[model samples]
Target: MDKDTGKAFDFRLFKRLMRHTKPYRLTFYGVALAAILLSGFAVATGVIAGDIVNDAISPKDADKLLFLSLLMLAILFAQVLSQLGFNYYANWLGESIIKDVRISLFQKMLGFKMTYFDRSSIGLLVTRAVADMQRIGEIFSQGFFVIVADLLKMLTAAIAMLVLNWRMALIVFALLPIIMIATRLFQKAMKVAFIEVRAQVSNLNSFVQERITGMKIVQLFTREEIEKENFRGINEKHQNAWLKTVWYNSIFFPIAESVSSIAVALMVWFGVLQNVANVGSENTGIIVTFIFLIELLFRPLRQIADKFNTLQMGMVAANRVFKILDTESHIDDLGTVEKEDVKGDISFSDVRFGYIADEEVLHGISFDVKAGETVAIVGATGAGKSTIINLLSRFYEINSGMILVDDIDIKAYKLSSLRDKIAVVLQDVFLFADTIANNISLKNNEVSVADIEQAAKQIGVHEFISSLPGGYQYNVKERGTMLSSGQRQLIAFLRAYVSNPSILVLDEATSSVDTYSEQLIQKATEKITEGRTSIIIAHRLATIKKADKIIVMDAGKIVESGNHKELLKKGGYYSNLYEAQFMAEEVA
Candidate 1:
């Protein structure tokens, strides 16, 4: 859960959320008008009822009462139609606004740097996209409509009561200050309680996602009981939060109702006293009408209080949503830069970078790949091999360094242009839950079937795909979980080959594949890197032995560099790693 204890309600953020409603301004106005008209007609019916009672009971005018009854029915019918219009328009506006917000948020999230994903949780992001957006829609559709209608009803009722008898109106209006004070207190309490509820909800969501995704690992380790206990703890926290909110609301609603009841009592006593002192007879119809109007006022007041609770919850959700939308992506596209063909001459000069501040991962590392050279990087885990490729692709920015392509700073090129020239295949390949052909083409859709088949053949996965029931149309599950590790890697290779990039990066690409797949991948790699600047990071010496140049890294520094035979002759780190691996194989 995000620590929001010290966070205060920001009015500026509320204004930002409201800005999304700008596109539906006309619809909002129409809904507001319809709500006001509907509420007015509702209040007027009480007045008509009073007239009918006075005529039928006291005056004994049956014709007058009959006509008034029909009039009331017509007004009620109009009120219903107006209410339906208000509801339909309000719903349309709310849904449209939320749709725009969700789309904009998704676009912003996609632009965020890779580091954002490393630090953020998938469950939390998904919660914002799905759950939070829905909360916002509820606020607009239900809360907004209720608040507006209640305010209109209250205002109109107060005016009508004042016209009927200013004394009774004053008596009733006295409750306004008391009601305001009560609502203000309830709002404060509900805001804090609802915020707690939202936090607990996020925590519960995160826990459920973790448990489900890691269930296999839990079962393998036989730790189901421990996982259940952890889930129970989170569930109890959510339950406690809800209980606290209900307790606050339980106290608040009755207090508001008691205040309304007190106002009603005062009005009735004063009204009866006035009738007896002056008129010498009870104007029971007037008394009843006054009571009906007061009920109308208090009904919505109670509803408004309830709506306030939901509105506060939605505000909490909006704050979280806006925080994500407001995040400034560290990587931005400078629109002034133009896309152009890249020569593939890559150079890093005095490059320094870090994932976190003040702890440099790459310290003044410098290297150059002459137009179409194949550079192999061999290093132990966490030696910054992947970091180098990440910086080259601008998936991350260098802290203090200059990367140049064709002797020009790569930053000067448009990000899309820079990335378009590069292709990468990592050991962990990600294939969408799509057909094998669609996965390879990445939804370009314009790539011909023949082109896909040729690329698959080049990567030596053509026959394997043909063996499947659906051939090229064979669908892979999310992350290609249905396919073998080697098959996924081969598809990744085909994806890269089809792009025909100027720079190729294969980071432990063949590490997970079997020996037969590895041989096929080696052949594919040679063809893909034939005329491109290639960087291959591999633990296996066999994969890097044929490189034009080899770089051996240790502790974030280049410990050795040379051709395969030259490095072997030097008898340094590379030669030692090679001999050690071979000796281990011989012993086995």
Candidate 2:
């Protein structure tokens, strides 16, 4: 699913992921200190046991035994405190780092070019931003630090064994290599399995999200059975990927348990022989301590496999998340100019653009709209009407030539400032699950309730809004489902009108509405386009007959330019298109 899927761990990705921790270095240092304390406390527990057996319990010295018992209890207390601190701070650091990472990822995506979003999957991105970030957090909270602490305990235990009885320790250490070999194989296999798991998770999420968003289409076309089968196949792949990890775990853990068991048995066998041969009586305490030491050493070796799996999964997620972070799809905002006000004079001088490289959608098109003038563009479906709107807002960069506003290149103005001066009403209006006033003013503090009401009044839709249950406070719900298409368009128009923009664009704004709504929209249009630079792109030529100029587009080129009366007199592209489409609508 991604490069480095074969790697059990990636140090590069790990380092990059850790960089987000710099801001919380104090918490990181505190967690590190706690981990070291926990390891030390763990080792002391075993040594204290030996002291109790040899110095107190063995000789039946009641006083010494009581003191050692209290000492061991105190060590237990310290260990618990250290563990508490370790778990808290490590998890705190993790949550903090992921919070910053998530925000940075969102900010980066916010600046991406429209072309980047045009082809990207929404569900896949949601996975990267939400699910993958938690995996990265687990790397710190439960993965890396836990593995290090466990290994530390093991190392300290190993040294204590060597000091107590070297021969028995060596015998126990012989089986260590066998466990290591198995663990290494397990890590590699698990890494590959986790990669597949993540890939399938993303695929399933994308499929379900698309199906849910377009559930209407599926039901309308009667495709539910087919979709269910597709989901089952994707879900099975997800399950099988996890089952592979389970299979590897099943084979590996039992082998590890057996080797450790044999190691413990060998230590006892050797210790018993030394005592029977009249060796040092001190071997009694040493034998008991070795029991604790062996558990410490081998148990982490077994448990490390689990933590390493988390580490591996986190690295895989980090790799995928970093790819998005490293993508260079942002539209350049290098322009130093910021305008307080803009004149709405617009000109596209031989402008050309393609959503994809070398596949031009608008080929060297040219047009001009002077301040306070209205221009209409009539085109067939794919004649590049929307592409012009995208270019003017700097959502997509022009491939060649210049787009000027007030005779200055659009690129010369700061992107935000340029967009602030324009408002667009598209054929499809999108509203959030927010109040109607919010959808209109869009939470701009400058536009108040009074302002929205006044603008709605000016656009002649105030009466429609006031008729609703809560008037401007009405919750339109997601995509404005509570409202009709005509009502949504009225909201869109009032939204655009309230902006008081220097330039305005209406893209098929009046299509797909009832006659009464059309009448209302026509009145709104007449008032809103009064003194603003307006660009109207429509298929219905009847809507723009009074426009000062009309440009006809076909297959990415401007075929005719004139007023409606002049074009009809010339019997050109606009006249022929108008005749055909108008006649068809009339017949219908």
Per-candidate Cα lDDT values, in order, are: 0.84, 0.91
- lDDT of candidate 2 at residue 20, scale 0 to 100: 86
RMSD of each: 2.2, 1.4
Give per-residue lDDT, candidate 1, residue 68.
92
> Cα miss at 586, model 2 (Å)?
2.9
TM-score list, all predictions: 0.95, 0.98
Per-residue lDDT over 361-473 for candidate 1, one digit per residue giving the tens place of the 0 to 100 score: 98888888888999999988998999999988888989987998877787887888888889999999999999988988888867877999987877677888898879988
Task: Give me the candidate number with maximum TM-score.
Answer: 2
The residue ranges of model 1 lying beyond 4 angstroms of the native Cα positions read 1-10, 176-178, 261-282, 335-340
- Top lDDT hit: 2
Once superposed on the true structure, which residue ranges of model 2 sit more than 4 Å away at CA? none
TM-score for predicted model 2 compared with the true structure: 0.98
Alpha-carbon deviation at 361 in model 1, angstroms: 0.7
Residues 124-187 of candidate 2: C-alpha lDDT, one tens digit per residue:
9999999999999999999989999999999999888888888888998889999999999999
- Colliding residue pairs in candidate 1: none
Q: Candidate 2 overall Cα lDDT vs. reference?
A: 0.91
lDDT of 1 at 122: 83
